[model samples]
Target: MTDNEALASASNSAIAAAVARLAEASASGVPRPPVRDLIGRDDLAAAYAVQAALTERRLAAGARTTGRKIGLTSEAVQRQLGVDQPDFGVLFDDMAHTDGATVPAGSVLQPRVEAEVAFVLRAGLADGPLDTEQVRDAVGYGVAALEICGSRIADWDISLADTVADNASAGAYVLGTDRRTLAETEPADVVMSMSVNGTEVSTGTGAACLGDPLAAVAWLARTARAFGEPLRAGDVVLSGALGPMHPVSPGDTVTATLSGFGSVTVRFGTGEAA
Candidate 1:
């Protein structure tokens, strides 16, 4: 290999080690510095790969791989982050909360909420130039989703590299009960509403997700495939959120309702709001 390739490999391995340490610290409730503090370079893909490796390690250690989440899908968010598209992260079984479920705050750090659409994958999607229709066909069903994100890095001041190494800030998620089959609905045009403590917070459409949630998924699939890690069947895909993310605290009740997908509620207890 060339010198640059060797250096890149070393850098990727180092970043992956750091991420693994961070994940262990988070899971064990140990003290640590912000992720940004440790990110010494601007290689976004390597950093993201490290984050994915951390999640993969967790999965190997018995954390069930339940789903995947898309982040930075909105134009505004992308502009703010200086990214042209969205990022993806893994979701664990322990992080999946049912509708109306109450969770302790200690499980997550600086939890934030975003309303989104969830797709249950029916088959595997390999690396390629995937069209929107192919993404829709790969999707088995759609449901309302709430992505509960948390940052391991202090102050939540992170660049794309730092965020990538932090697993795209995916912490927890809640899913709506209503599941619509792909053939029965239009995933792109659905409307959604999010509220906190019974107060309406935001309104948006699925189109906000790179024109449609499936499109976002397709983008993620392509990206992952490029990295030699294609998505497979039974993986739940969380399309990017529709509106601004809402920070949450203990005692907060968040409800994200979709026009045809119904609603999902998450109640944060003092322990679950970490």
Candidate 2:
């Protein structure tokens, strides 16, 4: 087979195996093996295929499709990875959490914390050229969210493509109680700051997310369409993080403060005893 054909075959095999793994994880309550190991090709195409298959299974099981998430939206992250833009992932009902709730650290592998903005989609958006105002109109409200990320990989060292296939290392999110109308909040005009252990660890501005976080959401909606799954209504799309990712350990409290949307805080469980 030619290279393209070989890749296609490999992707097909990976997708099937991924679906099986998903079933196994769900049944046994164990984390699935890192996609990098399960699939020989740790690329975005393979990852998206796995995501699509998993999404199909979730929909079949009566799970509600809420929205999408944009990862690596920070310019610092992009520069670190040598990429100019962000990646996307799907979000289901089970992946959400309410603010002021404590998240058990045991639920994820290699968990970390990130501060972000979330857009609740009021209208359907698909592939097309989208401007900032158009994106703002599509969003009904915005919330302060703390993204908890976990890696299936036993070890954290991985490439961008590998990370993408690992579902953008998404674990869960805590949505703040405070919600603001999009018309009132211009994503670019706000600043983001994160503190860990009562000390400021990182800081960034909303403009870090492609000039405007709403624009990031717009890019995600279009990108989802290009990937064959268009964004839909009632989706709470995470517009990406405004600051650097802070690694979390047991007994650590992570807090992200947005200029106007309020803040989200999560306390992690203690780490394994040495």
Candidate 3:
């Protein structure tokens, strides 16, 4: 075989190995080691390949695609990963929870909570220029949201590729009922406060998310189209976390308040969230 063929074979092997490790963690509810050792930290393409394969398996298993999630929008995580941009993951239908709902047991491992803004799209992003203006026009409405982040990597000792290959460490999410227009309340100016069991633990503003949640959505739209999976109407986009994420245990209740956008709450329950 030629050198190029050999290299491709090795890459395919690595992607498969990483997928198996992550899939086992997801199914068995046991955290695995970081996948960067298999896919490497800088090979983002290979990392996303693993994610795509995992997403395929879930779809084949009857999991319905809900939307997509943006991750690593925070500068701290970017610095940690040595990257300038962000990454994304697919959100399955089973990963959604309504406001004041419970998160089913084993839905995630090493779970943490962060507040964000959720946008439901009314227009397709595939044919647009993918800018803040285009995203503004595409957005149906904005609502306060909480992204329940969980890591399959034990202790969350993850590199960029590790998290990317692990589907951006996505868990479940809860969205608020109150919706606002981009004209009514600009996302970049929104303030966020997150509390765990009545004690405030994290705080931030919309600017923390790639300068603005709308900007983040624009970035995701551009990236997703580049990857051949563009954002479409009715998609629920989680525009990354606005603040530090706090850990949660069973029976812990998380509540996040978005200034001028009301709040969303979720409970960590012993049984299934449904």
- Clash count for candidate 2 is 2
lDDT of each: 0.78, 0.74, 0.87
Each model's backbone clash number: 10, 2, 0
* lDDT by residue (tens digit), candidate 3, 1-274: 2222233323778888999999999888999998878778767788788888888899999999889999989775566446667889999999999999988776889989889999999998998589999999999999999999999999988887888888988999999999988879989999999999999998889999999989999999998997889999999999988888889998999999999788999999877444
Stretches of candidate 1 exceeding 4 Å from the true structure: 1-17, 28-33, 79-84, 272-274
TM-scores of all predicted structures: 0.88, 0.84, 0.93
Most TM-score-accurate candidate: 3
If the candidates were sorted by their TM-score against the true structure, best first, what order would they fall in?
A: 3, 1, 2
What TM-score would you give candidate 2 relative to the actual structure? 0.84
Where's the lowest-lDDT run of ten residues in candidate 3? 1-10
Per-residue lDDT of model 1, residues 119-172, tens digit only: 998988884467677787788888998989887766666677666778888888
| Better candidate by TM-score, 2 or 3 | 3
Q: What lDDT does candidate 1 reach at residue 32? A: 49
Q: Residue 140 of candidate 1: its Cα lDDT? A: 84
